[model samples]
Target: MVVVRGALVLSLVALLLGLSAGPATAQGPKPTIVLVHGAFADSSGWRDVAANLRSEGYPVQTFDNPLRSPAYDSGQLEKQLATISGPIVLVGHSYGGFVITNTHDPDVRANVYIAAFAPASGEFVQGLLNPITYPGSRLLPPALQLKLVENDPTGIGGRNIDGYIARPYFRDIFAQDVSPAVAADMFAHQKSAALVANLEPSGAPSWATVPSWYLISTQDRVIPPALQRFMSSRAAPGRTAAVDASHASLVSRPADVTAIVLAAATAVQR
Candidate 1:
């Protein structure tokens, strides 16, 4: 519940995003900003955010996270990180945060979570499921719709399943803060994540050693704002910010999200 304003307000983005770091980087080049999207959405959701970052002269790449198990997805992201040079400011939104939590990428100088899940060791991002644990979260049954897909072989048989936010509840749960047109567009383009992702337990969180940041969306109907506060506090982030936006604040308020990313990037560049 910390209030940030003026110059210090800018500094809070790193802590708000739940990025906890040990030491400042020695003189180095600007780190590449790598963004990971979460469930029910695709890289397209980051279209505005990436454009803003690139406009700031940052090298930004929105990773098309395969909506699979955390372990498998993290492996994919780790491989992608290895191909890129220099340090990285790894950012994630929603379940994408769950995926990033499992990575141990050394080049990742800072972690920025934008209304995303930042789970701890052995913690499942599915913690969102407990109504008692995370009050006010409406991302539950009925609001969520699951579709079965074949040819995935990684399921309980030779089939797979994906979860999508029901169209009727999509705006209410994920993007109530945005305009109807934008929210509808987002829903139209949203991609489903593997339902098994909710079942996978997170490994040792990378934020512990990589320095992390968190941006909590106060009006978030997806993940409770209380949960965001809990996660950010648990991470012991060096900086943090609370925005009165929805879970899709990254869409309605990309600037706020970018401020946190910039703070993390500046911290790593130092």
Candidate 2:
């Protein structure tokens, strides 16, 4: 009787172990969707899109972009990426695209660009804008009305520390399609990006190796729709879409942005 009882106990342990491991093997791991915001905007810009993704049962994470420079920002993001296990679908907005381009975490399965700066290897944001001469191009046309803040503590020969869009032009330039009330609020809380960040060259572009999706904002005045199209063409073939929204499309058109993100997440699952 003792021998029979011991054998049964061992079998029960094995059964329990098998059951514990069953789900992981049968369904695999789910990919986490990470949303990154760009210059002049905080993580709050992704609030709507994040909510949409969460409603669909996707684990969503929104990172606060340093907006200091691509290398520094990407380094911070890399540390965050290390904490997440399984696959990742990285989505970037505006200057966040440059940050994502510099990050090549192996767990990243796909990259999504939303009215964002998609720089090639060694290409800086300013360099991309040098050739664009569109009528409503915010970067040019009497130059961006920026309030430059100095970084020097002693206040002697201090270089420009950061650049904030002048409140008066923020709505017309960045969020023309958004409502006046929301645009006013957005302008009020907007953050300043280090002026040097735009001139900093990018490292190897992750989109070159990872699958990518681009959502060009047709009415984008900041990056310009023409520039968006040119960048989208260099991405993985046939992985592009467009929306007739302003530069803040992620905020103004959250549903469309969420749909594209979900498509990337689905692709990663397969």
lDDT of 1: 0.81
Off by over 4 Å in 2: 1-28, 131-136, 140-160
Candidate 2 residue-wise lDDT at 255: 72
Report the lDDT tens digits of candidate 1 across residue range 1-270. Answer: 112221343445445545444233336787999999998888888877788777666799888898888998999999999988989989999988988888888888988899988888777767555778778988887988889987776667768888889989999999998888988999998888787798888888888888788889999998899889888887635467888999987888887887787777877776
Clash count, predicted structure 1 = 17
lDDT of 2 by residue, 1-270 (tens): 001122233233224222121211124355899999998788878888888777666799988887888998899999999999889989999999999999989999999999988888888988787654533467543435445566743223664567767777888889989889988888776887887788889988999899988888999888878888888899745777778899999888887787677666665664
| Reference-based lDDT, residue 55, model 2 | 66
Q: Name the top lDDT candidate.
A: 1
Q: What is the lDDT of residue 256 in candidate 2?
A: 71
* Cα lDDT, model 2, residue 181: 94
